[model samples]
Target: MSFEVDIGYASARGPREDNEDFAAVVRPAPHDEARGLIAAVADGVSSGGQGRLAAQTTVMSLVQDFHGVPETWDTTVALDRLISAQNAWLAGHNRRRSGEGTAMCTLTALVLRGHSYTLAHVGDTRAWLLRGGECIQLSQDHSFDHPDLRHALSRAIGLDDHVRVDYSQGELHRGDVFVLTTDGVHGVLRRRELAARAREGSAQAASEALVEAALKAGSRDNATALVIRVAGLAAGRLEDLLLRGRQLPVPPKLRVGDLLDGYVITAMLADNGVHRLYQARSVATQALVAIKALHEARASDPQERAMLAHEAWLGSRVARDGQAGLVRVHELEDPSAFYVVYDWHSGQTLEQLIEDGRRLDVSEVVDAGRAVLKPLGRLHRQGVIHRDIKPANLHRGDDGQWRLLDLGVAVSGREPEAARSLHAGTPSYINPEQWQPDDPVRADAGSDLYALGVTLYQALTGRLPYGEIEPYQLARFRRDPRAPSQVRPDVPIWLDHVLLKAVARDPKLRFETAEEFALALERGASRPLPAHGSTPLVARDPAVLWKIALVVSLLFNALLIVWLLFLPR
Candidate 1:
């Protein structure tokens, strides 16, 4: 099955001299099926002189420019960029015609991609969804209630230098009806009436009926309604995600001066058994980039191929400033092989810095922790967890900026249940709960926090908090490990306390959020530190206590045997 939609739109001048409302639906071409369908409606501010122009320009730009966005970009990201650009253009146009008047409008757009629909809105133009005979508003009005003016827009395009658009996304299902309308239509019609009319007939009939009903109800402004019914939904497939990567052949081994597509390899950056990283320069752009390719042997494995593709896909979803951005895949010319390309930065791995015995100042350490945690926070907010967070996976740029890298094992909120149990992170860095045999290991914000604490501790002193935990070893956490202060006397007392609390044996004891942890490091510990040696020996070192018990048992047995012999038993 494939995505199919029935779309209809209607606009009327009502009592107004001219219609200031615009609406349209643009269906993707056969080759652009992945881009899916776009429907939008815009309402121009009646008081504005160029209301008609603003409304028409806003809707037209959204439907046309949306297609120009890179196919690899997430729908929300693409829509946001397009909307922002349109806003800038409209604002500039208004400034140029400042003597005449300014143009302003409210826009609401819905993009149906894959099995989901993303809603982008600004101003008072509204978006609604009708399912199971119920109508629900999907977009919030940017207007406010004023005593003098019944309804005044608080936000709108072309009204300011910056526009803040609201966005939301939800799964799509067959038979779902989406409605877009200007305030004139929705303000006059009741929710119950709107739902009933929208569900009664074909999309075109429904749209017309809704607008007529609004006019009959005495609407004084221009009325517009756009209706979209999901006729069918495509069954999700892996190929949809893998896309080009699935069709391309795995890249072969490369040496210096070897070329693939437009990139020429300069040197081998890393060569782990599973994959290889090469430092290369694009012949076309003359820009440096890092290309990662799976080893030929592992390329045949479907799981490995998916992981590599997913890493690139996930990298593209994150904002560049938040994580190491992926080079635009669409820019690469037709290639003989598949590989992921990343923008190269001159930097040293945190692991290498630690291994080199570079002394880090307290301020430097705190700054690094804050920098790394910021991206991790962004990932968490996006419902992504970086299962594998370690010093080796973090880079300290020559510009003194730290960025988190390697999304190969990152788990998203939409990940399947079976995939959640798969062990994907470093054994030493994984939290205790993740290693429990009976407990299901799922990546969450707390898990990332645990790893962040471990990372901070290792950076401060080149040592693991729980030592090197082997993959086969069953991890057990009975007590806290040695504090950072114990290893480095120069470590501040409060900072040590903060780190200890972060990597606490219990997830509940750890800082609840990355922001909290960053704040603790930025400003000294908010709470008092526990006294040293507060924990008992049995809890702190169970292995040592067990050894002592074994020795005592042997001595007692030896004495018992001597007594038995002397008593003539």
Candidate 2:
């Protein structure tokens, strides 16, 4: 696939001094494997002694040293190597200025190879993806705190002798858009708007639009934007060509080893209370793979067996099209074992990316919505409901495509479809209808739709539609949620209304299905929603505040009184 990229960057000495010390560089790599594209963004630490020098030098040196990356190695390994190399360069640079260096800036670098991407970052600068009408953040801030910080970064390229650089890998698909920006651009634009703008015309235009939006929103620092769009894929399938005729359950455990068919188990990648994911390899070609299995305890329980079967069933259905966005599952040979096998993927989960506290641009959030909803739409069409859709379950693959995991089995018990009860899923991300005990486990795409809304809201605004509520409190979501934009003014008004509708307390008021909800979100970026539309319960009534306060006070008083009465008397 021939790749096309466009970048727009602007810096304003906004409301401040002359040194708009931020600097960025976009260069093509020399290696054929890399398809050779590299971009870096640096924000000079306004307070640090040598902020400008640190940023400029770091970005420039990174671009120069990038050619040294081994073309034979995987992108993940290469990214780690680059971060180490750059940090080392900065360390020596910092030492030379030792007593003189006062300012410290952050660095974020991106490397594109064929369709894959490797990202490394520091501070709050961000990287995002716009694919299938959604905007998805691809990097995390190394900041020490959330919202904003009054202090310098906890770690910068030159601040420490050795910096623990966190990085991840992802694949880029045709129409996939990537953005890199300083806090100046992100702090003001939000992810939904960024994603939407990225889609408007070219990457260059998107970059310009982002900087203008940030400036308009009152950015106090120098602002910059680097936009890269994956215009087309090379003529062949990247993964398919890399590993062919691979078998499952490689030499290791079913989900852990490479013995199942041709797939080889690399390592256990992730585990929650219910399932364990394994990073595996292809036995035939030694390709990296990801395998997912149910927890042993859940698999052992007779009640959970059916749920496990249902989960595998749904995985098979979704992967029937062999969409890279959805994980591949194997049919159980014994049907008695407690695990399912899946293709391994390398990338950050949405939860990991959001921990940086940076919100995604509007276009990025919408791209994410589409990535999730496209497969979800396929699942719904086939009568499958991914009861749980959250950052944790959504996987951004090495190919840059988004994949959904742990389908059908929100809780470990039975076929979610046949059950007439609301049983599983995480509270913050679960849909409103999922709270109805009488609701059937089947065709609740509305529930999934609500989850999609919550995911999009969190991605773009950096806040949940209902804020943070306890699991038991989810039952109260029977009412609509507050608009996301209201919670965070920078959130585009269109997104605020769309998310609220998706998570509408009443399923009737919510998007009827994943498809319907996705359409609204996809188009909502370009067109704002009507302000007079239905409002969510979260914003409509603070009456619950009084009730909640009374309850909290009562609990506190009760506890205090009990303590006093129990005292020696």
Candidate 3:
């Protein structure tokens, strides 16, 4: 949970009129540190006459905009987007100011995040690393080695509209040191000489020493160095941890007495052929926990492994980032095999409550609903869609707190390709739009909210508003979902209006945001909304309407015949 790092940067104009070299270390606030520590160095292409502006712009944009991207975006994707935009702007600016020399620079950026480091380079200002007393060059210069072409760069920012950037990544370790330098510094000092200075003292001191050494060595160009020392290794990406676990060979079927790491399996929670959930207790602390592992038969399946890995990351983030309303995912200490651990709460699923015929009243259902809305809103804003939202995926603790569960089928925009294609939410809870062949927006925040409405309606009425749909059936959403009050007479009219709007057949008719739905719930009867959940008699039940019409017609004809026959004409 600790993010320990040291960063320092130094720059000098040297013998030049302006210091075109720029170096910066952007250490975000503690809450934003998860995006990692960023250090960037840029050496301006001085021959172009606008190097200073280009260098400053390149590094400054990254420092300001990196964490502004959605957290669900992959690290590579986020960096690529920011760099690409900046490059395009600089390229366009060069055209507009044709007389002004083109703004161009060589960039090298480093991101130390989680337990790994991502490096992006273009016409490199060089990057080097020192670990365990060994120094290694981490980047290759884009300039030619031939003396005539040495001054010409094959690639650089603002050189052209399109730029091909080289990206690389590797595991990070404590005590690892990263050094970024412009040509003026590395061009004169030997690799070992540069490493010697970087190893001297603190990050700032080392950076200063590198620049001073470069100047002392008689380099004419502007010089700069950025040093980053890893004081501690943070948690690795969830995907990396799960991949390592996947490679460890799944442990055999565990019994009640089986011990994994320090936790002992206490009971089999559920076995659904694909996965096995078990209740486990920590031997040291005697704390209860839940473990989800692949079925032995599915040990070699790659798709399943990806799904479980993504689920772990998604659920873990949602629980950790928010105040409450979700079950927390726990990290095990050097587990023996692939599995996900969750902090177990003593509770029964909402599915169990409904199955037990414990019908929820208007107030109880509202409270249960408010508990889910907050977390649901958080997930949507984080760029995650919980495709599967149902009573079975909701848990109510003995302490009376409701928690949303099971993100196995959720989409976080970074899921594996195979996982992305699989539509795996429960059939009964799936919104009607996902079944439409023409509907473009299949499953999204609106879909989740629709499913939630169905769940609360079921909780109150003990029946699905649209009835239980079987898997693979082309759901003919020929009619709108029934109102809650219609199914359960005791349900209030205001409750009926809210739940109906949530499960409306036309997705646009449904609540646009979780906040909106929650507002209606909180307002209760005080500010009841009146839109449409009301369908015409014919659409609701055509056959029943026809039957009543036929009966009325027969009775009217009988009365006509009796009056004609009995009266003296």
Candidate 4:
């Protein structure tokens, strides 16, 4: 069963002249069923003369227009946008007819897509979830607590030009039950009573019993109730949640025995001053996973947290697209702290191999280059630039496959400013263009190729092309590096040419795409690339003119001495 559910709802005017309450469940055509089911209930504010219109229009717009929203939108974003638009229209209409009743209502909307549920709430409308024998309130009532203001709502649709709707989301289970109700039904009935009624029979019976019970309790207002019971959940796309505020709290620095969302930390992987890595194993499946979290000191910084969030999103995106060169990002379903999970692969990084004095021959260098560049090419095609691609960030798994690591600084265009604006990358491996005076931190395909070239060069010759560059230092690319063959005599001629072209001082001279550079390596000496000649002496040696001038003067003086000694003086 794919996302099967049972929905039932009931509404009545009770003692009022007519019901100003609305309840609906919208399911799209079978072909477009991935939009999922939308269940909502609204209570019109009596003070707003157009309360009925507000309640009806708000819920109707969402159910009717939701499927038409762009497919790229996350479920929460789509619902929030639709709700906000309806509020604006109601507010504008009220202003145009100032002497009449305003259109305002309290709303609670629920969207069940894939294996999760997203909610939008305002005013006193409520959403409840019954799971594991506990009935939990999923939405807060946006009303005042004072006796006189008890019925007064602090927030409602069309109450103001700007409406702040509370949005929430969580994992859905097979036997979970969800209920939506207007204030009329909830004000008179307690959670125990509601749960008891909701569990007595089928969803239809539960919905009818809640409304009838509320009315029998002497409620003066209209009563409404909508109930949904999940029978199954469907696997779906990764739904993105905005991490602006109310994100999970950052966990404190943990110990070996520490656990997060059922993952037990077995050992600490690394502890940079800003981020911490831990090796953990899932208690349920016993599968190993690596956890990345903000250091306790940096947990307070929002920018760092956003960067980590973006990294996780990017990693998941890459993994979902079936890019084998990246470590798989695992979803926690629900988590206790703000941390990222990745498949833990026991491996040594290329940097580690080099540090152990292991030198890679031409064949190994080519293999590594192709391994890193193939998926890198795919990532670039997807408009993502792996900003940091040094040897340390390239791990060679025990299975002998190389995987790119650390997308914390990747520029994916969809990421926040902190992920893109931050000048990030290993200085030694960064391309010359990234250090430009006019557009420093600029990155593109060529820059990635340049970094790959540097890594391959270092792996082949055990030395950086332009030598070691410290971070934050302005790197000069005026000097050309010696060919890889100069440092390692066994370096092949074809690879030497490719390295020089990849790390060329001018960006224009380097390979423009991973495919082009890859072709050069693939062809090898059989189809060696044409040499572009050496850098002009003036560019390679800025003091060449001065040296020439000094030499000329010395020669002229020596000739004068010889003439004076040989001829009459």
Per TM-score, the best of the predicted structures is 4
* Model 4 residue 293 distance off true place after TM-score fit, in angstroms: 2.1
**How much RMSD separates candidate 3 from the native structure?**
7.7
Alpha carbon deviation, residue 55, candidate 2 (Å): 89
**What would the TM-scores of all predictions be?**
0.56, 0.45, 0.64, 0.81
- The TM-score of predicted model 1 comes to 0.56
Candidate 1 residue lDDT tens string, 1-569: 56788888888999998898888889988766777889889998745459889889888998998898886678889898888988899889888888887889999999887656789999888899998767899998887777766578899988887899999877667788999999999999999998887876789999999999999999999999999999886533223345445666788899999998988999998888889999999998999989989988887776777777666666756744424322233223235687888888788888888888888887788888888888888888888888988888888888777878888788774443434567888888888777666665666889989998898898887888888887645444555588788888998899888888877766667888888887777777555455334346565444777889899999999999999888776
Q: Model 4, 180: alpha-carbon shift in Å? A: 1.6
Q: What are the Cα lDDT values of the candidates?
A: 0.80, 0.65, 0.84, 0.83
lDDT score for candidate 2 against the true structure = 0.65
When sorted by TM-score, best at the front, the candidate numbers are: 4, 3, 1, 2
Ranking by lDDT: 3, 4, 1, 2
Runs in model 4 lying further than 4 Å from the true structure: 1-6, 12-19, 26-38, 44-52, 66-104, 111-124, 129-177, 199-205, 215-221, 229-246, 255-258, 438-441, 471-476, 538-569
Off by over 4 Å in 1: 1-35, 38-241, 321-336, 414-419, 472-479, 525-565
lDDT of 4 by residue, 65-84 (tens): 98899977888889888998
Would you list the clashing residue pairs of candidate 4?
Answer: none
lDDT of 4: 0.83
